[model samples]
Target: MAGTGPQVARSPLELLNNQAAAEPPLLVKHAGPVIFSVVGFIAAAGANWATRRPLLSGVHRYVLIVGGSMAAGIYVEKKRAEHLATRDAMFRHYIELHPEDFPPYERKQFKDLFQEWIPIR
Candidate 1:
């Protein structure tokens, strides 16, 4: 007797293509942090070399310090932005899936919590 089971007949070429698509590209998946790390290392080495020279006066040193601090602040702010965006996306998804959990009034309160200003007039 022949087997009478539902079969998914996929061509070999189709399966290979599917697998290739499933695996992320090497550079796209892994090169980001590596490239950033290399660039950061190079920048740090250059900064160290520049600061070691006596040609940099007090003002130059101070400016470099302040500039490096600001760059750190900017990087932190960018990470914060990315985090907030992800959080907001998750919150939105949750709200969409379980709308009963967040009523209009509660939604307004949540929005107010993140708002820059609350009008009190």
Candidate 2:
């Protein structure tokens, strides 16, 4: 006997698979390695010069030391700013709810409870 029910439609997953199969490969697949190779060469050259011995023996050493320290200091400052922003956002929410100081013990308790629900690393 012929089928009694209506024909079922294709699900979204099937339609998506068909669409994906029709498209060309990603641009990055063809261009990524070429870009990476060029960048790697540039980075290697820069590192080599930054580390190489100088006409004056101590000059190269001093430059490398100062440059590295400055880079590290900038990176640390950026990270500290990001961390403070995150901490402030977390505390701002609490201050909005309670104007008075939240005790250290209570703050810890709240932090632990909140983190347990939605952990942040």
Candidate 3:
């Protein structure tokens, strides 16, 4: 919760903390092929006692390609979502506290500012 009452303002720290709580856990749980590929590459070099050349080489390529893409995609999506949510929250807070400060052009500017805050998906 940010704050109580209609006139109360949410502090920046409070907003951030509330946002953090509302957001999903930061970890990328399923790393796809990336994990297996890196491990396989290391193993292929015979660094581990259990290393097997054929298995390592066979899996390495697929894991590197598929898993790396999946992981990168997930990361980008999470970042974009966080940015948009923060922008939306800030915009709402501004409008609530300063309803009379905006002209039509300033409203457009706010919309533009919100869009600018997030990277294009």
Candidate 4:
């Protein structure tokens, strides 16, 4: 039964725990937000300056930008994973309802076909 299903893709943690998969680097994973981050940097800098906040505007901008990027990246990845997991589960159900509908023609369980996959928006 080890290879009977679609491979669940091994992540570092998955590999360690023997479960599901790996993830892209934060920069790569959250690249989409780079623009937003730039905008936010501008905004944070503005706020810092307008309020004359104790923190330096430049430092504040970088901190907010970096922190926001990392947070957004992690959040996006988590949501993506959850979405993928849900889709996979649905696929699994479909496989159950009509196994013949999928390929490999001889796959037993529904987890196989998934050695790895690219996440999409």
TM-scores of the candidates are 0.39, 0.34, 0.36, 0.42
Residue 79, model 4: Cα distance from true site in angstroms: 0.3
lDDT ranking from best candidate downward: 4, 1, 3, 2
Provide the lDDT at 104 for model 3: 30
Worst 10 residues of 2 by lDDT: 9-18
Alpha carbon lDDT at 51, candidate 3: 54
Candidate 4 matches the true fold with a TM-score of 0.42
Clashing pairs in 1: none
**Model 1 residue 55 CA deviation in Å:** 18
Task: Sort every candidate by TM-score, greatest first.
Answer: 4, 1, 3, 2
Best by TM-score: 4
Q: Which stretches of candidate 4 lie over 4 Å from their true place?
A: 1-57, 103-121
Residue 78 lDDT in model 3?
70
Estimate the TM-score for candidate 3: 0.36
Local accuracy by lDDT, each model: 0.55, 0.51, 0.53, 0.62
Q: How much is 54 displaced in model 2, in angstroms?
A: 14
Writing each residue's lDDT as its tens digit, candidate 1 over 1-121 gives 5665533323322322233344568765544444555565555556766779434345555455556655665576578769977876676566667766554432235766775877899
Indicate the TM-score of model 2: 0.34
